[model samples]
Target: MNEKNTLLPRQLGDTHIRLLRIYKVVIESGGFAASEIELNISRPAISAAISELESLLKMKLCHRGRSGFAITDQGEKVYQSTLQLLGNLENFRSEMNAINTDLVGELNIGITDNLVTNEQQRLTRSLSTLKLRAPEVVINIRMISPNAIEAAVLDGQLHFGVVPELRSLSGLTYSSLYQERSQLYCSEEHPLFDKNNEAISDSTLCEYDAVIPNYPQPIKIKHQQKKLKSTATSTDREGLAFLILTGRFLGFLPVHFAQQWVAQNRLCSIDSHNRYFDTHFFTITRKGARENLILEAYLEELEKTL
Candidate 1:
């Protein structure tokens, strides 16, 4: 028997490889026209590739007519095998390149909207450095909640994420960036302004209708534990600020974000002498994925700034 034919299914030639790849594209895209858009190849080229593939195998691979395209029975079998074969080849390439160069590929990152605003500049600086150092690589940034970020990374939709230190999930690794402190705040003209801690107890604080922003509402882990009563919730910071300014309610704000308000005496921290609440910010990635140089280097860059 010829060596090529004797070699098992594991061994294949370049022609076979190309055919399998094109077949997969055709099947995934549902037809030649869609494949042209996805593969950025001409329609004639896709049709030609498919024709050659069927000729070599002596099999009719697809059903085509005026309506659309559908894969034949034999085509389905070939498609499954092709997926495995192409995946193995790609992994082999990744391993070989790992020995010689920086990780090169696209990375999608999910982050909370709060982190987007608070850390946008620092992140932009890091991304700028990555673009300069590795011009061939691409990165996509998205804003999502902590829970959604975890789910996306787990589902392979996102390579990594930045989120608050929340409940733990399996197969995830987190690195602490820094600790953020928070404090109860109200406009300087509020009734509790300059009042002692006793005067600002739960009962007294609950007397007035409290307004707190719903999203990006300034994470206060301790405040969440205490569970003070609130009459209304607002999603926009402006709404929360407006209510506080009007002396309708007392709310909590991050000491850092609320700095200017405190400086101008527009908002007063309930207890200047006591440290009140805090949360540790963190960056998370799939545990097994840090071996990727792109992810490793990106983490390194973020660490330098954070």
Candidate 2:
């Protein structure tokens, strides 16, 4: 081979990129069989794509058999590099689109779970308005924990997050949306459920098992420490609700979220005086990141809804 040919780098074509994307989907979905519906491609086609990727790279990327699917060490490095390459490409697209006033490209958002039934949240209406204003924008919403939402936003994995205010992080900005009420609750089968409000003492409340938020919320921690037996914890409302409904533990739940159960007499607030604590929800974003027009427009619509 000539010196020039030996020195020449192998250029990745569009086909290679497509194959890498398929490979990525397969990895993300955990196996070829699981990825077929997600990729909208047949299992054989996916296998072919992975095989082609491996051939192009001159290495085995993964192993698949009756045991399970697992990526090789080389495959892990390639996957990380591919993610960075694709992410940078997306950023480039966003930057080029930013030159125009029109809102386009993807808008990734994260939020704590159990917002669907909350009447105070106007995310649906805000999204509808955003769709009307920027039909070209693709909205991706992820239901995550509060701490995860904050971390994802700071890491650039998410454009914005809707979460209850925790201890503030320095590089993020927060704008309050609303306050939610949370109250101590017990299932119908719990010992205290039938007891009159005045009959339950603080010491008695501390005797039973309690389910609490997995994430660190100062007030929740304080209350749980003082008045409940910490038995289990959860990051999402659904998990907390499940634990509470088992009649095995007491837990704190958003009053709005527990309302249906309360009406059905499956759950009851321990305090009849309606004593509760307030958690403030906020729209959180990176402090010094480049402004995104799509995010700005969406926030404007969200503010209007609020």
Candidate lDDT (C-alpha), each? 0.68, 0.80
TM-score of candidate 2 relative to the true fold: 0.70
Q: TM-score for all predictions?
A: 0.57, 0.70
Candidate 1 versus the native: TM-score? 0.57
Write candidate 2's Cα lDDT for 1-306 as tens digits. 765443224776778778877877688778999778546789999998898888777778899999899999999998888777665655665576577687878899998878777788688899999999999999999886676677667746688999886788998999988888787888999987855374466777778999877667767646644567788988678999999999999888888999999899999888645346788888998887666788888889998985
Off by over 4 Å in 2: 1-90, 194-199, 219-221, 272-275
What is the C-alpha lDDT profile of model 1 across 1-306, one tens digit per residue? 776454335567887787777788788768888667445689888898999888777788998879779999999998888767765554454454366476577767886654433433467777777777777767888775566677556544566787767667887888776666667777877887765253345666667667655544244454552455677776544566667777667776666666667778788877544525676777787766434566667777776675
Please report how far candidate 2 places residue 242 from its true position, in Å.
0.8
